[model samples]
Every structure is written in structure tokens, then in C-alpha cells.
Target: MCLLLGVLVGRAVPWMQGWRTRAAHRAAEQKLDALYSQYDDIYHRWDE
Candidate 1:
């Protein structure tokens, strides 16, 4: 299954630390940006 494969990939490589760490940071930043944009849209009115 893909889930198992992903888990194996995530854990099986010691040489993937920098790439994996950057990937995680990029993911977190994207999530944070999405949440902030959502909150901004919810709170601000364009034509009020």
C-alpha cells in the first residue's frame, strides 16, 4: 500500500534528513499561510 511505502520512505533513510526537514518546514509554512489567509478572508470584507 502507498501508506506503508510512505512510512517506509519516511523512516528508512538516514541520509534524507535535510531534504525531509526542509520538506516538513515547507509543508508547515504552507499550512500556516493557508490558515492565515482563511482567517483574513473571514474577518475582512471587501466592500463593507
Candidate 2:
């Protein structure tokens, strides 16, 4: 029983950490996209 519990914990920990990494990456991508959109808008306005 102890061995089984240990194995489950070992596997679950990394899987949970993977979600943190994914969330960080997603947030960064969104920030970059927003910045790019703002830049495009400014450039278009300047062109007009």
C-alpha cells in the first residue's frame, strides 16, 4: 500500500507542475499578442 501511494504521488506531482508551466507559457503568449495588436493599431493610425 505504501509503495503504491508513493508511486502515485511521484507521478501526480510532475503532472501538476506541468500545468503551472503551461499556464505561464499561455500568459506570455497572450501578452505578446496584445502588445503586437497595440503596435499595429498605432502604426495604422500613424499611417493615416
Candidate 3:
């Protein structure tokens, strides 16, 4: 029973880590996109 539990945990841990990594990467990309959008808006307004 313990061995089974350990094996399950071993698999789960890597999967969870990968999921967290992807989420963080996605969040960073979103933040960068928002920043660029804001910058573009400000630039266009200034140009007018």
C-alpha cells in the first residue's frame, strides 16, 4: 500500500509541477501583452 501510494505521488508531483510552470508562463505572457498594449495606446494618443 505504501509503495503504491509513493508511486502515485511520484507521478503526480511532476505533473503538478509542469502544470504550475505552464500557468506561470502563460501569466507572464499575458502581462507582457498587456504592457505592450498600454504602451501602444499611449503612443498613438501622443501621435495625434
Q: Give all TM-scores, in the order shown.
A: 0.59, 0.86, 0.72
State the TM-score for model 1: 0.59
RMSD of 1: 9.3
Worst 10 residues of 2 by lDDT: 15-24
Best by lDDT: 3
- Model 2 off-target regions past 4 Å? none
Clashing pairs in 2: none
Q: Model 3: how far is 36 from its true place, Å?
A: 0.6
Q: Please count the clashing residue pairs in each candidate, in the order shown.
A: 0, 0, 0
Measured with C-alpha atoms, the lDDT of residue 29 in candidate 1 is: 100
- Give the Cα lDDT of each candidate: 0.87, 0.99, 1.00
lDDT of 3 by residue, 1-48 (tens): 999999999999999999999999999999999999999999999999
**Ordering by lDDT:** 3, 2, 1
lDDT of 1 by residue, 1-48 (tens): 999999898787865887799899999999999999998887787635
| Worst 10-residue lDDT window, candidate 3 | 13-22
- TM-score-superior candidate, 1 or 3: 3
